[model samples]
Target chain A: MPLFFDLLGVFFFAVSGSLLAARRGFDIVGSFLLAGMTGFGGGIVRDLILGVVPTAFVNPFYFIPPAIATLLVYFVAPGVQRLVRPLLIFDAAGLALFCTSGTIKALEAGMNPFSATLLGVTSAVGGGLIRDVIANKTPSIFDPHDIYAVPAMMGSGLIAMLWMLGIRGWTWELGVTAVVFALRILSLKLDWRVPKAVGPWHHDTQLR
Target chain B: MPLFFDLLGVFFFAVSGSLLAARRGFDIVGSFLLAGMTGFGGGIVRDLILGVVPTAFVNPFYFIPPAIATLLVYFVAPGVQRLVRPLLIFDAAGLALFCTSGTIKALEAGMNPFSATLLGVTSAVGGGLIRDVIANKTPSIFDPHDIYAVPAMMGSGLIAMLWMLGIRGWTWELGVTAVVFALRILSLKLDWRVPKAVGPWHHDTQLR
Candidate 1:
């Protein structure tokens, strides 16, 4: 059941990636590659950091989601072009699951609580970061207008704190996921934003 | 001796990364962070894929070069503003060393030759890719105006082929490094470039 949810998360992430590629006017190869990378890049990086083989590399089934996502996006893009809200909802769900799972895995691997939380946030946001980077755009996490990573950080930090306090179980994990999902969706709907750089600092003070 | 060379490569890569950060008008924190990421990002990613702890994470000494690079760029930007040529030279040197070392490390870890070659190229270009992405720019490897990854590919492929043919030694490794370095330098000097999408293809035919 967990693996099924994980695959669903992968599918959702891949769909977002392919949609971005289509918007960027990339070809089919680009759509497929981006979908795959966006689906698996976070887990691959997380696994690598944990000194384990990436599940995507080991399981053939992991490849199916991205392929399906690419095809779906390519074929139905014209009709599904304005499904931004649905996409954001799916992305939020993926983020919730990934942050929880990543934190749990890192904690199980005996990473320090702080590091585990960091890794958790990475797992949640890393795929979108990779996708935006590949598409040559500012990552939403870095964009002050978006509160994307904050919810993941909050959820991961909460998980780490709970683990430290000896509270660990599926119920706790599920609760954390729900909290993160709600936070993300609410932030998006309410147009919540984080503040950018403050004080008297010129943007072009360094290079020019 | 190899460790020393590796550190030198890291330093060169960090300098290039810091230079880019400065050019992008990032503040001190951005400079340091970008420098650190570019310095060790490749080796860290390679180590992760090879299922080993990243040297950057384990070794405190590995952090020195990026710190120095950030300090150097931050302090000297006014006087050394037009060091693009020197920066490219340093970047090329780093590229040469990283590609060869990455391939050798993969082979030593018992990865197959093709995978080894891919890892090699990734090591050579990963840092720059990360840096560019963070700065919200197109990765140079994907830019048709630059032939950046070609030399790394050539070097990594040659190294893989040689290893498969049972030809392995420091001398061969050094020879391959020289070949890749020269290729990169010459390509830059001659303004050589890879061709963009050639066939009849519209750039903005998909999304809008």
Candidate 2:
């Protein structure tokens, strides 16, 4: 069941990546590469930090999501763009699943709650961060216009706290995932944003 | 001896990262974070791909280089700018050492020659790529201004071939490192660049 959600998250993330690639006019190879990165990069980063082989590396099934995403975008990208912000919805779904799954994995690996939370959040955000960076865009995490990382942090933190309190049921995990998904979608719909740094130096633009 | 070279490479990479942060007017915390990423990010990526705990993650000594780099940049950044392209020099040295060291490590882990070579190039370039992405700059690997990954590729491929031919000595490793370092420096000095796409559609900038 966990693996099912994990692959679902990978598919969603890969779709978002392929959509971005289509918008950017990348070639087919580039689209597949970007989708693969977006689908598997986070788990790779998280597993690396946890001193384990990323599951995607050893499992052939993991490649299916990115391949499917690339093919889907190759055919229906123009029409896909007309959906209800398909990119953001997919990204949010990916984020929600990854944060919950990552937190569970970290806990099972014997990581402390705080470290687990941090790692879970990293797992949720790392892929999109890499995608944006490679595409030569400012990373969404650092962008002041949206509340991106906050929901992941909240979801991961809640999971960690639940684990510490011995609540390890799948029901709880699903509940947290729903909470994160709702928060992300609501934030996007409401144009909610985190405040930028405050103080005298906030307006300083001397440096590039 | 390998550990010494690895730390030296870490130091050089951290210095380059810190210099960039200093120039960019990042806060002290940002400078240290960037320096740490530039110092340890490559090896972490390599080790993660190899499915092992990163040396920097386990050893306390790895933190020293980034700390020293942050302090140096915090104090002498203005004076340091007068030197002969300090950033490029440090970056080239890091690239050389990482490519050699990463290739050696991958080979020791029983990876095939091609995979080892590719991992080595990834190790050499990963840190700088991360740093540039976080800094909102076009990653040097993708920039058309100069050849960056080529030197790493040459060094790593040579190292892998040398190991396959039973010439796995420190002397050969150093020789390859020197070759890569010189190639990178010369590429920068001569303004050498790889060719961009040759198609008439290359001028298409319709995508963001």
DockQ of each: 0.15, 0.13
Q: List fnat per candidate, in order.
A: 0.20, 0.20
Give the Cα lDDT of each candidate: 0.80, 0.83
Candidate 1 lDDT tens digits, A1-208: 6677678778888988888887788988899899888889889878888888888988899989999998998677666558566567767887888898889888999877867876787788888778877788766555444578778989999999999999999889999999999998888878886432211233345334
Model 2 steric clash total: 0
Which lDDT tens digits does candidate 2 get at residues B69-99? 9999888767745533898789899999999
Error of 1 at A168 (Å): 1.2
lDDT of 1: 0.80
Q: After superposition, which runs of candidate 2 have C-alpha atoms over 4 Å from their true positions?
A: A1-39, A49-51, A55-126, A133-208, B26-33, B48-51, B67-84, B195-199, B204-207
User: Candidate 1, residues B73-145: lDDT per residue as tens digits?
Assistant: 7655543347566668878888999999999999999999999999999999988888777877677677665
Name the candidate that leads on lDDT.
2
Q: What is the TM-score of each candidate against the true structure?
A: 0.61, 0.60
